[model samples]
Target: MDPALLKAREAFKKKAFATPVIEAKRPVTSNQESGKESNKKPRKSAPAPVAEKTFDFKKYKPSSNANFACLAKIVKYMKQRYLDGDNEPLTLEDMLDETNQLDLAPRQRQWLATEALKNNPKVDITEDGQKYFYKPTFPLKDKKSLLRLLDKYDQRGQGGIPLEDIQESLPNADRCIKALGEAIIMLTRPTDKKKILYYNDRSIQFKVDDEFQKFWRTAAVDGLDDAKIEEYLEKHGITSMKDVGGKNSTPMQKRKKPTSKKPRNFKKHNEHMGDILQDYNG
Candidate 1:
């Protein structure tokens, strides 16, 4: 081994270079910090997503309102025909042409003439072998006959007749009603909004003031049930008088029918084949 070279390397290591010193950092100024903040802008948030609209694909049905409207037009046409002295029932095509409703779709026209007219109370539909004919529900042919019927109703003391019936029966019904202004009382029923024609008996009727009539009508306890009405009346210092005791009706007893006797069973002289053979031999 070379001892001299090893000793020389150890001596070189012992005379090594001195350690390097680190430099201190300078402090940041307020102006530099403000400048840095000003250079950087605030980030914006992303916008919310919008919902997509969907279409409704439900199947639509044919409305009865359109059918009734068409039926009304046809009825008006029928009334006009009756006025023109045509008592005969009109065919489907004839009615459509006369009412200027020929432009309606074939299916709609067919439905209007058949089902709509048949179901309507104001219309009378009749079939002639292959095709249908439509007419107003007229029990009588003329205005005179309608007046006679009304007079009959008045004589019978039957409360009143429906004006709708007369309208459906007679032509120029409005004119007839107007002509009978003083002779009849036209009333509207609250339940169904139906117009009723009451025969005004001049002998029994006396004129009442319009103001008094209005007051009476406005004082009605509308939209109240019987219990609520009673409560309201009592609250307003008005109470209905209690009913007095009356004799109660006795319930009738059901009568029983007498029992029928059953028929007696008689013995047969020759019930078996051997007995029948002996009888034959005798």
Candidate 2:
């Protein structure tokens, strides 16, 4: 044995005698040791309240169909006449004649007139003794401008001739100098209420109210005739006359038949058909 080997054996034997250590687990606590718990289960949240909606029954109700059939017929006739290039405004008499021909009742006729007039502002009613007449308020070409003028006048609240006011209201005095002068003359002179005066700008204002009546009376005294009225309207470039039923012609003429031909062509057609049938048979 060597001295180094003896020392190594002694060191191995001493290191083989090392000890092992273990730690103990702690005890669990009961409910009494911890805070007390409630027996009741937590309440579930209530569902959010739903909002109630409101509805209006009136909004769903059907509207009245008053005068619908008559209105339709009038509209159809007017449209046909319009498309045929008849630019003349339909008179009340013309409309009444058409209604009567269609066998519409008096009430229905009135309703039709109201409806037509509502659609066409150019249609107006005038009185001649016990009779009523319808005349065109605007020309076919100037309908839009005429409507605009009607709206403008209605908005301005100036129904009567506002000659001085209109002249003063003009934007350009230099450009409208001649028109202003003419308006002054018209204001001073008498003219029919049915006669309209159109400005260069296409705005229309009628001669109305007591002042206009006074003017007409004075013109009548001065022997003013239809030709003079026409000349005045021409000077102002007025394209249409409204409420001219009794004013346009004499009472007798207004009462006279609008058409010279017989009522429709019923007899002529029957005769023509008879001749054709005879020829065919022969």
TM-score of each: 0.40, 0.20
Which portions of model 1 show Cα errors greater than 4 Å?
1-71, 127-138, 141-144, 154-157, 174-195, 200-282
On a 0 to 100 scale, what is the lDDT of residue 172 in model 2? Answer: 33
Best by TM-score: 1
lDDT of 1 by residue, 178-263 (tens): 87667778889999999888777678768899999999888878787666766776788875422332445899999987699779
When summed lDDT is taken over every stretch of 10 residues in candidate 1, the lowest stretch is 239-248
Clashes of each: 0, 3
Top-scoring candidate (lDDT): 1
Q: Whole-model lDDT, candidate 2?
A: 0.49
> Which stretches of model 2 miss by more than 4 angstroms?
1-66, 89-93, 96-101, 114-282
TM-score of 1: 0.40
